[model samples]
Target chain A: MSAGMPFYVSPEQLMKDRADFARKGIARGRAVVVLQYDGGVAFVAENPSRALHKVSEIYDRIAFAAVGKYPEFENLRVAGVRYADLRGYSYDRSDVTARGLANAYAQTLGTVFTQESKPYEVELVVAEVGDTADGDQIYRLTYDGSVGDEHGYVAMGGGAEQIDAGLQQDWRPGMHLADALALAVRQLGADPAGGEPRTLTGDQLEVAVLDRNRPRRRFRRVQGELLTRLLSSEDPTADVPVPDEDDSPRASSTNPQTQRDSERDQDRDVDGGADA
Target chain B: MTAGPESGRLPSAYLVPGSSSFTEFLSAHAPALLPSRRPLPPQATLDAPHGTTIVTVTFRGGVVMAGDRRATMGNIIANRDMEKVFATDEYSLVGIAGTAGLAIELVRLFQVELEHYEKIEGTLMSLEGKANRLASMIRGNLGMAMQGLAVVPMFAGYDLIEDRGRIFSYDVTGGCYEEHDHHSVGSGSLFARGAMKKLYRRDQAAGDAVRVAVEALYDAADDDSATGGPDVGRRIWPTVGVVDAEGARFVTDDEVAGVVEAVIADRRDNPGGAR
Candidate 1:
């Protein structure tokens, strides 16, 4: 065929094509939910791999959750950590904020979308637990670097629309940790094709939180018996131990070996009170 | 990862998938930021403040580390209340004794190093791994150490794997030596170690550990002019840190003061400390 006179594709068409490709890639992954509770922010992801994490702590009070290709989002996660650490080192510990990190991620994602060959197929939520409930902030960044300042709750990845709808129907302000976690799991199990919801156990889900009651570094992972108890108990909050100010129990009160064995059994209960 | 256009985007080095080490990243991207990279005058015997007398004693469940509040410049006291003890992370503590300014800067870098690794890898470094990382950091400072500026730090932590408290000491050349029971570093380390040898007991409680550390510092101050004893008049006390299954925390001043008063009162009875 004679070289077709170079047909020009408009900028808008090219951008739309990239966006569609990225969205489709992201939608193939499992869902992640982030919501604000009475004490702090809770992150629940339908991730079964203990070694590979979908949620991580970025700074003193900031956390990150993402859904998409693991390697791609992992790159962004590491980059976010570097930015926060470098900034905190250069300035003060309090200087690192989720908004600043979200802005940096936006810049990187936006640049890559416009400049690189393939856009990153990742959607991220950056949450910071503030001093008060009203002060909590969550920023959602999409493939094209657009930001949404969401309040209360956010869901992303495959079946996100359905999960978001479920969260909207049930999520309320200042729910207990157990109620919040149950709501997230229920929503994550919602079927996109309008089928019956699947039940997710503690092993099948990954959970963590930015506990406002914690002293400086507020991020803590919830797993093992604590996760099961939170999922099964009717009054989980009644006996749920808030992590001490130091993030661990008093050294003199418990035996080291026993503490370690219990912690191993429970995985990581950030509240530091699961065994108690 | 090249030096691309000057834009608001993150440097390629930060985005590149690579090692979890923060210092390594800083070295590759901003070599000037590393404490060991600063160029010093060759063969220069610079007069700088030197912190003295850091002691670490293992209790039943954890470790207690304490440092006297003095930084000396030759015959003069450069700083009366220099903090030489720092909680490196939740489960670890570090006490520095060397060039005061450089040592503090090294501690800061080491703190960031551990924190960066934890955040990147989603787990705390093994106690041995942390000690090795600190060793390499000190090795980097060998360049400055050879020029009469050195940083010697005592590292103590509650090892989850080992299920007990552990201590690690380092030399000027970054040789990491695991010390059992108790250890000390600084200008007055000799005297402090002697006192600890007498007072440190196996399976001591946390309160006993604090007492032993303070007593060790007191004995060091009595013999070494560089070390400072508890200053009751100014209400200045030695900084104490405890690391155990619960994590690391600094002992409150009031608590340290109570110990200091008791030690001083006991010293009034015997010129020399307990045998």
Candidate 2:
């Protein structure tokens, strides 16, 4: 719309401008977690509502999630559900995989961020379970719509780095649902003595999983006393020493401190798939 | 093919904020996706499996609606214990009398449309808005209905604000008409309604309502071949649910078993099924 501007701009400049705008908006809100567990993934967010939910089934296998500005993300959620349903209706349900859905969201979010005046101030995660037990995959998409492939665990939100650091030593394979859920909660929970003063309940929190026992429908909200019971009952066997107080780094938009923060494990786990 | 999201070009309906009715949105965007868009071959009378009688009785807290499980296709009985009725939405249920496939599709789409509206707008549509939306959906399928496939579904749901249960009936043209007191629809509707007339009480409780429904369905099956009674051999019974102030909750298998057992006993003692 502006005159005197060249018809085309460099892809680098375009991408840079879009990313900056998206990062600013997203940094303003809390984050959500998409934990890839042994059987499937669980999306846990510290939302306080029995009726309103952050996690919902987009389809049989696919799910839609957001952490900031509910109205904006909710619209995306509905759209994602529509897209998924239509895709499944048109083609086979299996082909409507999580990766494909993430790509679609990336395309739409990236397009809006780059072309529209205001970018969506939300972050999303699209996860899929593979054939074998260990073939689960989680794709974390940032505000700028840039997609990141995550292994074992992926964290988002403002204080993501702190939690990621918290998970650095504790997260490991063969961790049961209880361990994974408790670890996730502790990572995101308010500190013993901290700045925020808000009490959360089992009903306030939302949890769901792509369970091995359950048939096609993997998305279910674990609510009220049930979730609270599960969270409190988890045995804290591998509680990592709180991120060494001295080494704790602030979370940035790009580096919301995923467990990969420690370079040692990054090479081993991130590339552990290369051998396979 | 329906005009799905893949087509970047949305119908004019997408741009404007129209009525809260999601069925209207579908009508404008892609009518083909709606159940009534399909064309059907004309016929004098369809001897297909006609779903059996539904009974809705208003009670103290709310209302309970139930139907017998039988679908008779001409001289030969077809699909004994077929569930002809279902809860269309959270607070509402639909019972079909015509083609099962089309009716099921209509019910499923109605569910999706409601969900879509709720997602787009944080709140659920009013009971009236929901009823109207279902009507429009029925209208969309008028094309197929004219040929021979007509679906008349009985809808019942609770109205939280009003603190009552509302049941609705529809014609082949998608005309929605609210039913008062007790109502029944299907081939055995006459017999079912007669039974409901005798059994129904204005302030019936949850249990009494279930018994009334069972009695009505029994009468329908006794007179009409299209209506099926509880099958002890197959362990199949009428799928029933209650619509009260809380919400529309289906009767569990165990609970249905209890009610059907009672109905079987009463029949054994008094074959007429009346006190």
Which candidate leads in lDDT? 1
Candidate 1 chain A, poorest ten consecutive residues by summed lDDT: A251-260
True contacts kept of 1: 0.36
- What's the true lDDT of residue B117 in model 2? 61
What is the clash tally of candidate 1? 0
Worst 10 residues of 2 chain A by lDDT: A250-259
Tens digits of per-residue lDDT for model 2, B223-255 = 987778778888877877687765555676678
In Å, residue B175's CA in model 2 sits off its true spot by: 3.5
Q: Candidate 1 chain B, which ten residues in sequence have the lowest lDDT sum?
A: B1-10
Interface RMSD (Å) of model 1? 9.3
Deviation from native of the Cα of residue B126 in model 2, angstroms: 4.1
Query: What does candidate 2's lDDT look like per residue over A150-265, in tens digits?
Result: 88777776677776777776888767776888777777775534667444456656777655434344555565555666667553433222221221111100011121123334
DockQ of predicted candidate 1: 0.27
TM-score of each: 0.90, 0.73
